[model samples]
Target chain A: MIDPSGWDLPSLTDRWRSATPFGHVAIDDLVARAALDELRQGVSKEPHWPNRGEIFEMMASGPPQQPTPRAFLEALGGPAVRDALAAITGYRLQRVDGNSYVYLAGSYLLPHTDHRPGVDRRIAYVYYLSPEGAFTGGELDLYRCTTDGSGDIVATEIAATLAPRPNRLLLFDVGLTTLHQVREVTGGARISLAGWFY
Target chain B: MLALHRDVLSTDERAQLRATLDAAGWSAHDLADRLHLATANAGADDALFARLLDLANRTTRPLRLRAFQWLRLRRGDYQLLKHDARERPPAAHVELIVDLSAAATGEAELVYTDGGATLFYVPQLPGSVAVIERPPALLRYQRYLCLRVADAEVHRLRLTLA
Candidate 1:
């Protein structure tokens, strides 16, 4: 059901294993165009709850119970996909948790290392649903952080940035150094399927 | 930064401190109703904070230490954050917050790519106070208090004490 029709997983996994800072991989046109269009339509129709907090801004919908979302989830949670991800990251794949975010203008996610106790989130991924160039200023910025002489966590600089494009999938492990934030959306809407493989 | 006064609070200052603490404890809802985002009137609260800071810093004062300890337990991660134009870090500032949980301890300093470094670490025990002296040159300076606790027991001491 995932329609992994485009990606060459073996090659992609190798690149991820050797990438800098920590292991991560990405691919564009991840889902088949027609299937994605249908999924987008189904996702847009769901009731969303607005999240307004110091650390996050955007609308969120719980994981789907219906078929469209179920199929998408099925693909991610499927054995082939899970095994490929595990082989790439050198971690066991027990489950994949999924949700979605709808970020409109002025919404942003501030910096935080997404490490919480009891949630053994090994890998985090985002499947872009919004078209590229349809919006501006919603790039995922990853920071290079270190504890300075004083013992405070200082984000020295932005090491990598990934712009959102429709049907692109981004996978990054939840390492101690994995500090990232979503820059404020200056205009229009940016939607994406967010998940974590644990 | 908290200005410490080694001298005891004057009668008038003590009365003011009691009144202010009582207002903060009782009229909290009323005050919140009138509060605006990112704005607060420190008023006499500054002096009280300075006094409390002074009391906590003097290791020899056990009575004052216990009082300050009680305040910390009652008020979780308590802080008075301000960004007045007059008291600000110079360009290349890093506002740092270190949480003061009873058993937690540590500090951090950041060095910019230019080789210039600024210290933003605060003492890591309860009642430790420090101020952000400048805004960072590259990124937005974040103002906050980080409360580090050793265990859940330390976090729930307020209930036990009450």
Candidate 2:
């Protein structure tokens, strides 16, 4: 579990500025090992909607029945994480909302922006539960966007591929130009806590 | 396999269509030529591509095939492709769509969605073209393709949206 007491965002603005392709940053060891292990167990056991298709996403929604997952999710949305996120992304996040995701083999999310109106979500974020190399092919692929003068959009080359690692936090500004995708998982499974910061 | 539809083109029309594709840079009927121009043209000739595809994809008048494009799925890869625009500001202008499987493949499907809720799904067939009429804005849809390398044929698919 993350303790927010005496929390200070360390060089958060500097790090985001140095990140290339887009304004984003990732940090490892975001949670204690014991707490993370518990979260993985709790999340894996939660009832997730296992809807499979070409453009795929399986969600384990909250309020969670599993104690560990519920605690971890709450901690992630708590002031500590929110404050860290706000400093890093420069958005006054009102709250965070998301569910656990399990991307097993054949599961993938297609490329698109997170620009749903009235959502009030400003920063897209994810925290991986599965250990690195535990799963294959679930890269958080980010893209470069080009817009015609009239607002027509075209996603160009991929600017970065952030691998889903345990205890790592991946966050980005959410907008029409912020295109990203979770590539198809070819083996095992990818478990993560994901949501948007408002 | 999906129920193959009545061939919309006559013998002469088919010949003329082939000539048109040849004149318009689609000389070869093989997989590579078709797949390349379809994806790589970058919409520079979208109208031309759409027009030629419409001719090849013509099903029946007033309900003609809207679009025709192909996909090549290799081993251990997704055989099925999404039917609509993968990006937002959906390319909903074209509606009459058809998908054709030219090589070895697995099961395919036509699923209809209403506000993300699936209303219906129809199994698709290989070596055949799948057709979709212009769905209402209330209904969203996409095609499902499952291809396998063990099928002993290259999975070649032609997709059309009207």
Candidate 3:
């Protein structure tokens, strides 16, 4: 259900390549209004568990089992969506997988590049589903990195911060320099369907 | 495996050590998302080292101190498991962490894991110490010090023995 008007391959390609700190593009109203509502309702009913680790603390759902979310994910992996993203980002993406994430009060994800050797992840995407004014402080922070001669990250500084606005979709290239994090959710819940385009 | 020794240091001893560390030169270690904390080299404290060594020999095995350091974590600081340098294969060592904070914050914790399952935990309790045996495949990390704990400070004396 991606809007065709905003999917202009030539313009999006330029924007993605020139984005600061790394390659990324943020598109508002990425999907039709009706589909967004259906996806949100379906995701709210899915079972979620507290997923925590050294770098992250948040609630996460497994792969979608409901019809609506399942269908939405399938659509994303289909040729229409995949081809559009491939044209813009220039990554030879073959498939997509996703899960629903809920960042509640005090939840956060520290800075990390989504790069994992041999995992085949090419692009990372987040579709924000939090209603307008539903949350505060859960911004997506991108960091500009200073790497050594060996291409190892040694220092970093905040380059950009994207609010978790409803109906917004963020897609970015994943590599050694794509350092990003989710700022802590201070007040309300920040919900989204996030995963990788592999 | 882990063993907690509560009230290991008296109030005066804790205060003295805190003062010493407070006055020591610290080096900030930052790597974007992996870790952000200050560390300093602590001078040799023979009596305390001997006590910890004796405790470890009694609890786990005979070992000698390899190194020790002072770690200070303020708000918004953390050390992730992936960033721990002790993750080398065939891990064989015992680690001791002595909490020397001015007050107990109960926010930061040292967590040991194996194959993604938690094996041991050490909380930030003033005057308490934790002795943990590092088996092969064992991983450890300090939980993030969140901003909600206003102005809370965590000072830990970490010792490695082999």
Candidate 4:
């Protein structure tokens, strides 16, 4: 569960607006300490499958079937959290859907934008649940893109690298310029809950 | 299906081909969601083409060379499934990929997939050639070259027979 009193909505909104290379913000300790353990336990119990392709290789779980994790997902899509996120990013997010992900050693995701025409995805988010000091080299990398007159990406360069620190939440705009990737996990596993708000 | 032929070229022959390809000009293809690598068109090599044709004919019906190219993937390069060409001749075809790297890194590989399921894999082994049947729905892509393998470079010669 989230603790609204701990959040400074005005400051988060400012940060989101001023962020570079397309809008994004990272919030640490987003979840209430008392509920964190239950959430992690529920996620760990879910079944996962190895999803591999040319651009990515990682373990992904479907929508949580357990009551605790399912309830947490419902809370995320509920009006309170949705309004808070809307205030920060200025996007009218109606609902959210997410799945658990595990990036083990040698796993990676190459650069890509989460944009798709007519998909209606407005914002993307990742909630890091990995244990402290459990992994190395699995950073979320954002890229700065240069687009041509026709609005096609012509070039790109790294703009930011965000560590998957436990209990941190990363939110970014979903658009053509928001190119990003998950760097390869060289050591232990990197676990997280990631999804998009529509 | 996939078949691998080891030591298809002699050491000296492979080295000569590598040297020639190394000297040719290459253009970068940098589409983020699709691919990021260097590609070049090599000069016509009638002898090599004939040899590849003969090799492919052993397993498949008689075919003719349709196209060929050189690919170079350095560290941090990749080719995603979306980049595979969708336009192809209606008849069944085969693809031949000859590895020419100085040494095999084993990180980069060619994978063929259909409906999200992997059908075959081609490892990166120098002096080896992979022959793969190309059906209309089959898609192939080269895996990403990770940066952990310092100075890793993968050079391959790809030929299309239809």
Could you give candidate 1's per-residue lDDT for residues A1-198 as a string of tens digits? 564534576788788887655677887777788888888887887767897543456899888755677688788988878877776778888888888788887666765566667889988898888866777778887766665687454334567788788888888878655777787777888988887888
Q: Name the TM-score of candidate 3.
A: 0.90
Highest DockQ against the true fold, candidate: 3
Ranking by TM-score: 3, 4, 2, 1
State the weakest 10-residue window (summed lDDT) of model 4 chain B: B82-91
Tens digits of per-residue lDDT for model 3 on B1-162? Answer: 888999988778988987877677778888776688998656878998899889888888889888888899998888877677533335578889999887877689888887488877898899888998887678888888775666978888888899
lDDT of 4 at A137: 85
The window of 10 residues in a row where model 3 chain A has the poorest summed lDDT is: A1-10
TM-score leader: 3
Model 1 chain A lowest lDDT segment of ten: A150-159
Clashing pairs in 4: none
Segments in model 4 whose C-alpha atoms lie over 4 Å from true places: A149-151, B1-4, B23-29, B40-46, B57-66, B86-94, B102-107, B114-119, B132-137, B146-152
TM-score of 1: 0.56
Flag the better candidate by TM-score, 1 or 3.
3
lDDT (10s digit) by residue, model 4, range A34-140? 67788888888999899877678899999889776787778778898889888999888899999999988878999888999999999898999888999998898
Model 1 clashing-pair count:
14
DockQ for each numbered candidate: 0.03, 0.17, 0.63, 0.44
Per model, the share of native interface contacts recovered reads: 0.00, 0.08, 0.73, 0.46
How many backbone clashes can be found in candidate 4? 0
